[model samples]
Target chain A: MRAPDLIRFARDAAAGNPLRTVLLVLAMSIGVASVVVLTALGDGARRYVVNEFSSLGTNLVIVLPGKSQTGGFNPGNAITNTPRDLTIDDAQALLRASAVRRVAPLAVGTSEISVGGKLREVMVAGTTAQYIDVRRLPLAQGRFLAEGDWRRGASEAVIGAKIRDELFGANPALGQLVRIGDRRFRIIGIMASTGQGLGMNTDELVLVPVSLAQAMFNSNTLFRVLVEANSRESIELAKSQATAILKARHEGEEDVTVITQDAVLATFDRLLGTLTLAVAGIAAISLAVAGILVMNVMLVSVTQRTSEIGLLKALGATGGTIRTAFLTEAAMLSLAGAVLGFLLGHAGAAIIRQLYPVYPAYPPDWAAIAGLGTALVTGILFGVLPARRAARLDPVESLAKR
Target chain B: MMNEPLIALSGVERVFQLGDSEVHALHQLDLRIDSGEYVAVMGPSGSGKSTLLNLLGLLDRPNAGTYRLEGRDVTTLSPEEQARVRSERIGFVFQSFHLVPRLTAAENIALPMVLAGTAPSERRKRVDQALKDYGLTNRAGHRPNELSGGQRQRVAIARATIMQPAVILADEPTGNLDRATGEEVMRLLEELNGKGVTLIVVTHDAALGARAQRQLRMEDGELRQDSRQCAPRT
Candidate 1:
């Protein structure tokens, strides 16, 4: 028969049993939709984490005060040897590198603060003027500490939004004098309300000059040095140059670990990519189950239509023709189910995005295509047994029944 | 071409396995049918009438025989070749009026042509003409369930003749209808025979057999008698 006629005939046969057709399509569609939704969730989680990391800063390189080495760095030596301290001088010397744009020497310590009559413990972060630019911290009011020599002490402090709201309430906080660790300092600025990052919440922080924070804490060592490269391409260069500069400052000992932001981002990206594939594979199992459903339904259909098969055979239809017709019916039903599932999956993803606006819940194109291809292949593969059974039916026997 | 019979079966034997025992359905049966002959095969149940009809329709093969159709030794043809011959030269009508329940009467009538790969435009035209000729034009869109017994039988007949086959093998074609409807269906088959299409009807009804030009009586898996009327009853 011609292709169009064959297709129409199969379509008519499928439509004849409305309940069976709907059930089969529903099964197949559910399989496909689950794959789409789960893959979207997996990819969405990856995107969310990547976006959070991107929010930290662009082209950033972080330097931590440790010789935490992998692969033959000698764990015994790391535990026994006291690593050289990362100080403001090492942070200053990094400015000489061509790829380095800005550097901030961070010093963190806990101190009790007394403002008016209120007293509370607050996290104190001490850094230079470039700290605002490197960490991308926003100021709600007033200016940051004056730019000057890194060793000179400044009595100005910047309080976070939570600190302002807690200690000053309706009263203005900027320019007010606050006593922190037995030293009175004027509030220079109030930081904007930024949510949590890594573990620290910027909304409750108090920023001060590096020298004053060192003096108050009685420490010369820095917590972490945040370095910003000039551009994306210069991130690796900035990392290597900062490490080299820090090693020279520490008497040629490579004790600091300089990590580029892209390295961390790439690691997360690969981990999440594998996770998305794993979930998609799990979802594909449902498709195989749906294919088995198709096989079972088709087997029942063959038995139900035995007389019709006999009639066709009596009307001069070859066994091959009958097989083609049945196979065509199976394929048409599968294609319809696949299309429905594709739509349902996208709709499910859309609903996810609607509920969680920050998540980019879109199924990857490859996953969608693979899901469709697998559904089709599985449907046709399972269809073979029933089609062959229909083709091999004994016409005389079939026609003899009823 | 003028001397050769349309169908010639000789020494044909058909066996059925009933448990561990073998029952011969047909034993060395020999028969010949000519073009345009209206032959009735009448026998009681288990007398091999349906088995003979099935063999004539190529739905089953003889255990040991050479069956020739239009001078071709069709018994030796491959299954595919036999199917092609069946499609082009043979048509069948069943007692149950086996019209597909899902299709409209028109689609059912066009089924043979569809299976034979007939062009859509030609299939449509021919199906339309058959529907009109069978007095089913108004019921073209009706499904088998919506059709009366006589109407469904007419649709089956239309489907049988759509391919314009040379031979029509009918197995108790009027058995499912009332007396009045049965007579009408017999007349339709007679009319087709008058138009030079060979008609072979298998039945147990004696009255129906009397209307045919030739009647073959079978007993104990063998032909007991073959008789031709001088003037067949119209």
Candidate 2:
């Protein structure tokens, strides 16, 4: 038969039974929609983490004072204690590496800050003037600490946006004296509001010079070191150079961990990428269930339409033609369902994007195409049994039924 | 000189197995039908008249037979080859009219031509002519349920002859209609036969059988009598 005629026949047959067709299409569409929406969520999480890390700094490397016993760096290792202290001398030694552009030695401690009869416990981060440039932090008011002697402590502090708001309210806080722990320092700068990074809210921090913070905390050990590579291509070179320098400074012991920004992003990327594939596989089970539903409904249709099959055969339709006609009907229903599912999944993803607003919950292109392709293939594969049965039916017996 | 037969069958046997017991539906049947002949097969129930009609229509395969159509050994042809021959040379009309209830009258009439892959324009032309010839022009868009009994029968006949087959096999063609509608349907079949299309009608109605130019009576899965009559002018 002509292709148009065959399609018309299949369409009419499907249209003849509205409820069955709708139910079949609904099942298939639900299967496809679940695959798309779930994968969107999985991939969305991966992208969110990657964006968060990229915002910290590009071509950046972090140095923690502890040796991570595990080979790879885990985020949890940031809190572990080390066998040796990483001081300002270790931070300065990293600059000798050809690939290392700058280094900021960080001494973090919690202290009570009292300003104009207002006292609040805040996180204190101590580093050099280069800390601003290396961490890509912006200042909201006044100037940061000047480049001065690393050994002689400076009595100057930079308050975070939240501290300035809380302590000084609407009044100017720059050039005001704030007492931190047992010492008083003049507030030289106020930092812009950076919601949160790593585990600390930068908006709630108080920045001081490294030597002063080390004195206030009664320790000469540094908590972390932030390193910036000269170029993107030099990140790996900078990481190894810092490791070698730190090992030499710590008496031939590699007592500190250096991790590149790319390594962390890649770990999260691979972890979440696998998770997306796993969820997609689970969602594909629904398609198989939908395939079974198609097979069951088609079997019933074959039984119900036996006389029609017989009539077509009596009109000189071959077995292959009958099979093709039934399969065409299946493909049409599946394709319609897949299109409906595509729209529904995109709408669902859009809703998620709107709800979170931070993450772009768009399903991957390959996932959408694979969902549709699998739906079609599964529909046709399941259609074979019923179609073959229809083709093999005895025309004499089938026509007698009517 | 004798004209070559359009259909010939010899030593035809059809057996149906019912739980290890074989029942012979047709046994040692021999028959020949020429083009343009109007033949009626008449028998009581269980005498296998329907079975014989099905075999002649190629809807069923005989277990042992040498069946030839247009000098071709159709009994040995593959299933696909048989379907091609059926589409090109054979047509069937059933007792129930068997009009696809979902389709319009025009689509029903064009079904055979569509199966034969006839060009759409030619199919349209032929369907239009069939509708006009069957006196169903006004009802071309109506479905089977919307049509009257005689109209449905006319549509079935139109569909059967749409491919312009050499033979038309109809089994109890008017079984569901009133006597007047049945007579009208039979007249239509006779008119087609008069135009040189071979027509075979299977019926238990002796009066209807008498109207055909040739009649075969069956009993006990065997042909009991074959009779020929002169053409009756209506």
Candidate 3:
């Protein structure tokens, strides 16, 4: 038979049994939609994490003071017990590396800042004048701390947007003296309002000179050392150089962990990439279930239409033709279900995006194609047994039944 | 009529195993049917009339036989080749007027041509003409359930002749209809035979069997008589 006629025959058969067709299509489409939506969610999480990490800075490396023996670093390790301290000397020493562009030594501590008798506890991040450029932080008002001797302990602070808004309100707060941790410091800059990122709300932080924070806190151990590479190619070189310099400064003991930003991003990238595949695999199992459903339904349909098959055979249709006709029916159902599932998955993803606009919950092209392709292949593969059965039916026996 | 026989069967034996004991459906039967002959095969139930029809229609294979169609040894042909021959050279009308319930009369009539891969335009033209020839043009769009018994049988006749086959094999062509409708259907079959197309009708009704130009009577899986001549039964 011609291709169009075969398709028409299959279509008419499906139309004849609308309930069966709907159930089969529903099973197939649900399987495909789950794959699409689940993969989209997995991939979306990966993208969100990657974006968050990239937002830290480009070609950046982070140096944590304590060496984690397990080689796994967590944000809580910043304040953990350490055998040695990474101070301003180590930060200054890193500038000697040719690949290193700038270094910012960070000292983190909680302090009560009182302005006009109004006191609020805030997270204080202390760093040098170069910290502004290294962290890619923008200033909303006034200049950042002036470049000066690292040991002199300059009394200057750059408060976050939220801190400034709360402390100063409508008044101009730059150049105003605020008492932080029993020390007076002039507000030299106000940071632009950047929302929460990587577990830190930058808008609520108060930046101060590292020398002053170390003196006020009565400690010389630095919390973190943020380093910038000269270029993208220099990131690895910078990491190794920073690690060597820190080890050398700490009596040849590798007491700190120096990790490039790309390494962290790559780790999360691989982790989430695997997660997407795993979910897709789990979702593919449903396709197999749907395929089995197709087989069962088609087997029943063959039994119900035995007489019709006999009529076709009596009308001179070959076994091959009958097989092709039934298979065509299967393929049509799966193709239609796949297309509907594709649209449904996108709609589901769109709903997720609408609920959480921060994440782009878009399904990858490969996932969509794989889901549809697997559905088609699975439907056709499972259809073989039933089609073969229909083809092998004894026409005489089939006709005799009627 | 052509000199060469259109259908020739020799020592055709068909056996069926019903659990243990074997039933010989067609016992060493030999028959010859010429082109354009109107023949009736009359036999009681269990007399192997249907088995003989099935073998002649290529719907069943004989356990032992040599059957020839148009002077070609069809018994040695593959199932696919036999199906091709059946599509090209034979037609069938069932006692129940086996029209596909989902299809209209027109689509039912066009089914054989569709199976034969005829062009859509040609199939359409021929179906239209067949509908007109069978007086079914007004009922072309009606499904089998909506049509009267006579109309349904007319549609079946239209479908049977749409392929323009050399022979039409019908099993109890009027068994499900009243006498008036039965006569109408028999007249249609006779008209096709009159057009030089061979017609074979299998019926248990003596009246219907007597209407054919030649009569074949079977008993106990064997041919018992040929009314065309006082010839010895094979």
- What are the chain A TM-scores for all the models, listed individually? 0.84, 0.85, 0.85
- Candidate 3 global TM-score: 0.89
Q: Candidate 1's chain A scores what TM-score?
A: 0.84
Candidate 2 structure quality by residue, lDDT tens digits, B149-186: 99999999999999988999999999999999999999
**What is the C-alpha DockQ of each candidate?**
0.75, 0.70, 0.72
Order of all candidates by lDDT, from best down to worst? 3, 1, 2
Docking class of 1: medium
Q: Residue B177 error for model 1, in Å?
A: 0.5
Question: What does chain B score (TM) in every candidate?
Answer: 0.98, 0.96, 0.96
lDDT of 1 by residue, A139-258 (tens): 889998779999996799998899999999999887899999999999989888876555456788888899999989999899999899999999989988998888778766788899
User: How many clashes does the backbone of model 2 have?
Assistant: 0
lDDT measured at residue B127 in model 1 versus the true structure, 0 to 100: 92
Please write out the lDDT profile of model 3 over residues A275-299, one tens digit for every residue. Answer: 9999999999999999999999999
Ranking by TM-score: 2, 3, 1
- Worst 10-residue lDDT window for candidate 2 chain A reads A73-82
